[model samples]
Target: MERPRRWLEDKLWSSFGPEQASANLRQALSKLRTALGEDADLLQTDRASIGLDEARLRVDLLEEVVPGNERIELLEGLDARDPEFEDWLRQERAQLQAMIARAGPKEIRGILITCRVDETAPGRDRMTCDVLSNQIGENISEQVRAWRQADPDMIGSTDAPQSDVMIQSQLVHEGNGHMLFIKAIHQPTARILYSKLQRIDRLEAIMQSETEIARTVFEAADQIVGKLPHVLAKDRPETRSTALSRLGLYRMFSFDQDALREAYGLMDQAFRHDENGLYLAWSSLIRLTQMMELAEADQAALMEEAVELYYRAMELDSDNGLVQAIVSKVRSTAFGDTAGVMDLARTSLERNPTSAYALKSMSEAYMGSGELQKAFDTSARACSVARSSPFKHYWDTGHCFISIACNRNDEAIIAAEAATRAAPLSRPAHRSLLALYAATGELQKAQSVAEKMAKIEPGFSLDAMVNDPAYPVRTLRNKGLLEPVRGLL
Candidate 1:
């Protein structure tokens, strides 16, 4: 009900006073009318009544955007000097909040935390996180509640929706390129459901990225989420295998020795339950990784086991590019067989040119052999495939190896540092960094890297590192750089 002019007069009196109160009200009403000119019918007013035309007015926040609990305040910064008007505004907001709480993210469950948009970062990358977040919304295949930022009260509490899966996304610029990394996290259990790292330099191609970026990221985001429903499925062993393999990959890239082995065991279980060639290949790859990083008891034995696994993988699917890629890497790293590496890499790439695993093997083959430039080129391609990926750093170690061989010591140091940052758990990255430091005659840095490597893989020896087939030709080059450190070890 419209209180008489006396009411509004009191509401603004503290600031505007009664004299200007009426004038202020008239002005505000006029402005309101102008703002709502097209929807003027929604504002119902008569001599004795001032109210919204209930039937004509529909609140977008309340009716749409289900469980829209995102709003935290109402009429913020407005000053209704009179207590009654202030109370009215508060009550209206409370009513709206009640409605929102009642909605309770029903149709949409689960949370998605996109990295905060960074304002200080350079290039179109400033809003890359936000663009990916918005893109995820557009392409999300399932109905899950999402938030740019989660409400404080909802975290770590069972009272919130039981949706266990959450997706955490980050956009990073590595050296010269932009990378988008996304991971589906199981909130309650605190486990990763799935994760993805994709190249996003394509954003630069957009006419106006601020406006067009989301569309490009949308397809990328969708592709990841589209696989989520299946990958995150708990009932299916094959699906669980997919999830475990992803975790294994993350751990492998990060240099987490124990975690990767655990993933390998889980993959074994998954494979046994359902004979998935993917698991077999990954299992074999992880075993080989142990030989290089954790210092497997018998390198030859590990190599033998890996080859047997790959044989089965090939038997299961001769055309599996990822399996083929790992086999090529094993051949390269174990035997220093450059020709075999080259042949397998080409064939694997032919099956899946986009496979980073294959590209990495190709890079390793070139570095181990005498093709430093081609190795560099292939490593660059792998980094481009997923620069934000841990695999990028994995391949980057080889890239640095090639760079050092090419007499690009300075560049090699930079690439080595980047590799270490990308995969701190990586023994090879640390070794590369140490070798680069020693080669540059920076014994102090080399000593520091040696200590770090020892902590991760106790009693880490340069002999084990230098003699390994990881970088055959480069090993000879780093031998002098490493010999002095052998006594220190």
Candidate 2:
């Protein structure tokens, strides 16, 4: 690649004025030439522009050049303290990662989805059925493609009959309405991976229920992808990466130090293989979770890493709704950037209305801004959309906090208990339950929750938590809600 001198100055030293930027660039190029020494001739430059001799340079990132055993990042940790340069670097890294992924060995899995209208069904509108089928198919296709870990090649059509899974559906008359019976069958194993019946009361009502139906089926298919590594037993890097990512996601919610460390390692491994925006976002979320659960003294280091990872994730895939949602949560909790969190969360919801994660983040932003009513409503939506999801505890925890802030003690207790039941190993969930139990004068219940917390963290201390600025206990104390729990501890 060739770059004009002016462009280089603006990119590398935008923080400084033009004169200073130009001088700094010249000084940096002079040092680079000195370091190049014998390879100095490869650094081709003119009065107007600078270029590298691509023919002579053996760039490992290029498709033609094979990579080494050691993993290396392009210009790793080189920061010019300029926003423009940082943006450019992130884009370049994303492009390089994409190139490498295309060059690597991987498997492309496809789903052959077909919908047929039952001839026995009365008053069946072909147009309506076609529209409904297309909508559901498109929804599933979009959801699958969004998950880079799954590595879905394409949604197979009649023209392209090849597929790993066949999702067949039939629309038939039901009680005063129609029912769509859907089943996902693995092509090789001939196993039914998923089976569900979606009820549509009316042809017009199909639009309303389509999103939910697609989500249910897509999540099931995603689970199958998570287990593909075991079944295929091939050296498929993408399948292995998906398996690692799934394990990491489950472990990340444990809120235990050792489990979190293991989760981070797993997520890091997946990110290394895929280098995807979602992978980076998940890794960043793990870092933020570690920051919350780790000792206050160790939080600073985790915070720095989390911030860098989230920023890079955003830069690589700002349009990705899930990526934006994860980054928004990090910004809301770790950086306390309420304005940025609200913007990112809102955009995420706009892009993917079914995303419970975005809804939770938006609710948190509202709570932090003292918009209790908005927070409550948004939190409720989060819970509703997250129905039966394995990660429902996350939304429930947010709802518990919002309910507490709104002085809905009964609702708060319900949500807290629900969160605790959903994730028994989650310290935050236990803390929420304990807080609610204590605040409502349930001493025995509070003590039981506290005991569970102790089991999760052997060195659990109420005093330390209440005083530590890193924990949410400080916020609860400021609100005059922790005094009741303090007496029990």
On TM-score, the candidate that comes out on top is 2
lDDT of 2 by residue, 90-153 (tens): 9987776665555466554433454443334454455455544444344343322322211133
Predictions in order: lDDT: 0.60, 0.69
lDDT of 1 by residue, 1-489 (tens): 235555656655545666687777677777889998888666666554356766665443432222223476666788756776787788978976775455332222233443334455564565555545444443342112233444234354445444434544566767666676766555556666556676656655332332234333333443454355343433333333344455456556665657666657756754654465766877788778777654455778887888888778778756656667777877676677778888888887665444456677777777767788888887766655546443568667767766766777787788789888877777767776787677667888888887898788765666766655554234535545555555445
Error of 2 at 19 (Å): 89
Residue range with the least summed lDDT across 10 consecutive positions in model 2: 142-151
TM-score for candidate 1 = 0.51
After superposing candidate 1 on the true structure, give the runs of residues whose Cα lies further than 4 Å from its correct spot. Answer: 1-232, 254-257, 334-337, 461-479, 484-489
- Report clash pairs, candidate 1: 108-145, 109-145, 255-425
